[model samples]
Target: MNTTPAQLPHALVMIRPRSFGSNPQTIGSNTYQQTDEGLAEEEMNEQARKEYDDMVAALKKADITVLSFDDRTDPVCPDAIFPNNWFSTHPDGTLALYPMMAKNRRTERRQDIVDYLEAHYELKQVVNFAPFEKGSRFLEGTGSMVFDHTHGIAYACRSPRTQQEVFYKACETLGYKGILFEARDEGGRLIYHTNVMMWIGSNIAALCLEAIPEKQRNEVLTSLEASGREILLLTQKQVNSFAGNMLEVSDPEGSPHVVMSAAAWASLDSKQQELIKSQAHPLPLSLDHIEKYSGGSARCMMAGIHLPLKPGATP
Candidate 1:
């Protein structure tokens, strides 16, 4: 990655949910992607499109450029809408492809998508971990870990989708310090992804204290504080509402903004809202239908494009 000051990206890549719905393969771990037998497939797709359009419009209105891609339907990548789980780009023009735990989710990784991105931006390196899928060990990109890029710190909660060995290898390759721990929800099941429990920005962090074990909570807190970051504590209920699934991006004007789903934004109290607002503008998008079946919110829908632009390419 780039050895420069850490900041939110000015561009984002969002995949349209062409074939969106709950996946039986992921239902065991993604508690949020609950299927509704009553809703017709046509109606569900319409609702999903409306939500996706609204979110894209909102992000663009905030002066954040969006590179939108339509999800393919051939084999039906159900969770294709949540693109951040497959790959992530860095400031130094490094692109990392992660190994997904879900058999179906692995299909979400497409070479054409990366080629389309490269057509507009300049990426210096490609870190491929998809080969590790043969061993069954996985690291679901940013979905499995919340990165504090500025401090080179990675906060991840161990789960079926996030293995420690894979996590450490990725961190080691990226030169980040890994802080691994177990985090459980109210039902005592492990939270599938850390982004749903912890979110780290340039100098701010939002985390669910209840998710982390009591013994390990202090260590996480200390690490954040030592990194010179202000904390916004979230409750388990809030985390369930996707409160911790927020992403920070920059407007074309160069101002920082925090983006989240309306459901996630609504879960926060006035105090918590005020604290976050002090750092960046909150772009609360309406994505009710998408969140209902995809098990991901605004952050997961957006894969920030931080790679340096190729010659003659606009930012």
Candidate 2:
């Protein structure tokens, strides 16, 4: 029932201006357009890079510690923005590498990023689940499993991208328990990403409870209540604006900030705004082109690296 680590005192986020055609995992969503109006791969990449640069500048202005990295040619990897899906950093300085669903996405797991992180932060262990890919079983990291780090509980929406066995194994590896649920959109389609439907903050959690089936709604509600989290429920319309896909981060001065896309913020009602501001300052950046083409908002672009606090210091 704990809820502190979920509020990131420090985080590592990525920006994608050249985000198009990068995430092969979204092929099921038909994320790509077949019409000529669709951007060429090169053009999309260029635009994505530019958007990413702009986003980084905005975060820097807020004094957020950002570890930025450009896509490299070493492996021709795609869908790198969802780095949280490929790997997760733990408070104990351990790293967990997940098994990706898409063939192209498997290539996105780069050792170089891990090497860089190790140099800057303390790294104790590296637990990899990529071998599951050999058996065709997948469990995309935060995209599939949402960890309540403070309580050591992992909540995951059932989907093709999230296998139940893999989910259990991940929890076991992390010394946590798993709470599996089924979440569907208004159209009754399974939500593609866990972050799209629910986001856990320090004292608050933004979720689209309407997406849960009647049979499972109470279970989800009970879990949230049990965790001592204040809920900020969103409607179907808000979910479309990426409302639930938000991350609570901190500035270099250690002040809490809620990060989301401008589009998501625009969809919020005054009440929702008040509820969010009660917890942290709102930070909304323009990711129109990036979101329109990538179908991932601000939260998807970030990978929170919860390294241990330094000696005699506050994180």
In terms of TM-score, which candidate is strongest?
1
lDDT of 2: 0.77
TM-score of each: 0.96, 0.91
Off by over 4 Å in 2: 1-6, 13-19, 22-25, 29-37, 309-315
| Residue-level lDDT tens digits of model 2 in 1-315 | 113354473767463423355354565742321222567888877776776778788877887878887776655655776677888888878889999888877877878788877766677889999899999888888878777777777888888888888989999988878888888877777887778888888888778888888888887778877889898999988888889888888766567888899989999999999999998889998877667766777888888878754444432
**lDDT digits (tens) for residues 10-79 of candidate 1:** 6888888887877788888888778756788788888988999988988888878898889887768888
For model 1, where is the 10-residue window of minimal lDDT? 1-10
Segments of candidate 1 deviating more than 4 angstroms: 1-5
Worst 10 residues of 2 by lDDT: 29-38
